[model samples]
Target: MKPSTGRQKALAKALTALIPLAPFSDAEAIREAAGQRKLRELPPSIAVWIATVAHVRHEHSDYDALLDEGYDRDSARHFVIDQMNAVLTTWRATRLVEGDEDEGE
Candidate 1:
């Protein structure tokens, strides 16, 4: 595998910092950090991992909805991740077709 580049490393570092915040947010920083394209620029898996962890930690509706649908917490998490992956794949494919290598700003 290729070595991680500076931006890739930065992405990792950002996640390291952001993750501890999980369910809490400071408005300005939260807006700024999330507004930065870096979050979206991270590899989809990593991005989804962060989102899932945060959502699960906060017990967001997405996670709860699975429980409402009869999935146990463990099963719900797996189900959400699988669904996220499918959607992410479709989004990437759509971006490729649009010829905009960047997913978006």
Candidate 2:
């Protein structure tokens, strides 16, 4: 619902950072906390996945369906956060990888 806390802010920041990379990152937290249960992590790929799914499919209910797909309560929550942050981390890694490519070019 409302990201009213510092943790929420951090999560939002992380998610935003991870968006550009796409097809990578973690995105677990963002998935679990879709309804704002806890802080959202959300990797770039998952972030894009969620956005694309939302845009193409149900609109907004994709996250809940995803959460219920397999993850238990804690597992879903933790994994969502981890996955999202992982996406962010992966995106940074991708940038580094691309930078290396440019250097070669």
Candidate 3:
């Protein structure tokens, strides 16, 4: 295998630090995915965010099944927002949804 690029190594380190509460297998998988060629083009923070959100959406929520059941994309996302946010909270990542009082901030 090719040696990892500096960007890949840095992204992996950032992801590990960002999601310390995530399970070992999940955390490693997210880091591996974030180091992919496409994601490496983005800023590390944004890549990490995307990878984490995707992991939560697919693994921690019913998003795929909702889509399979014919829920529209937006509606499926809305239905799983709470479950997604709960996983985010557990991992100490920023929650995607906010309460009304958080809106003005």
Candidate 4:
């Protein structure tokens, strides 16, 4: 899958802002702090996780949707990290296909 685009960022920001006004504008900041990417494709689980974080900060309708979908706290957390790793690996594979070699490999 392609990396999350600027449109995604804007939508995420708008949705997050409506949720409850997170202390931060970009949730990716938190992901990066967790050693994740700032902008990349995410699995549904991770997307839920990111949305959950925003929701926990401010439970809006969208967040409610995630909860309604049966996302538990543990799952949400795990999903974020797992999704990040998955995205990174996929990105690396894509780079390889594009003729980009791994550094020193």
> What does candidate 4 score on TM?
0.23
Among all candidates shown, the one with the greatest TM-score:
3
Q: Write the per-residue lDDT of candidate 1 for residues 5-103, one digit (tens) a residue.
A: 655455445443434333234222333343346566665435534443343323332657777889887665555654544443432322111222122
Candidate 3 lDDT over residue span 1-105, tens digit each: 222888777777677667768887888777777777778778886677778777777899998999999999778777888998888778886446543211100
**Compared with the true structure, what per-residue lDDT tens digits does model 4 show for residues 38-88?**
423554334434543443323222334445679974444443443433332
How does model 3 fare in lDDT? 0.73
TM-score of each: 0.31, 0.25, 0.80, 0.23
What's the ranking of the predictions by lDDT, best on top? 3, 1, 2, 4
Which pairs clash in the backbone of model 1? none
Worst 10 residues of 1 by lDDT: 93-102
Each candidate: what lDDT?
A: 0.42, 0.39, 0.73, 0.37
Off by over 4 Å in 1: 1-9, 12-49, 52-62, 93-105
Q: TM-score of the candidate numbered 3?
A: 0.80
Candidate 1 yields a Cα-based lDDT of: 0.42
- Number of clashes in every candidate structure? 0, 21, 0, 0
In model 4, how large is the Cα lDDT of residue 70? 96
lDDT of 2 by residue, 3-103 (tens): 56666555555445545444422344343344243213644344433443232222222334566697564443343443444444544533221111111
TM-score of 2: 0.25
Order of quality (TM-score) = 3, 1, 2, 4
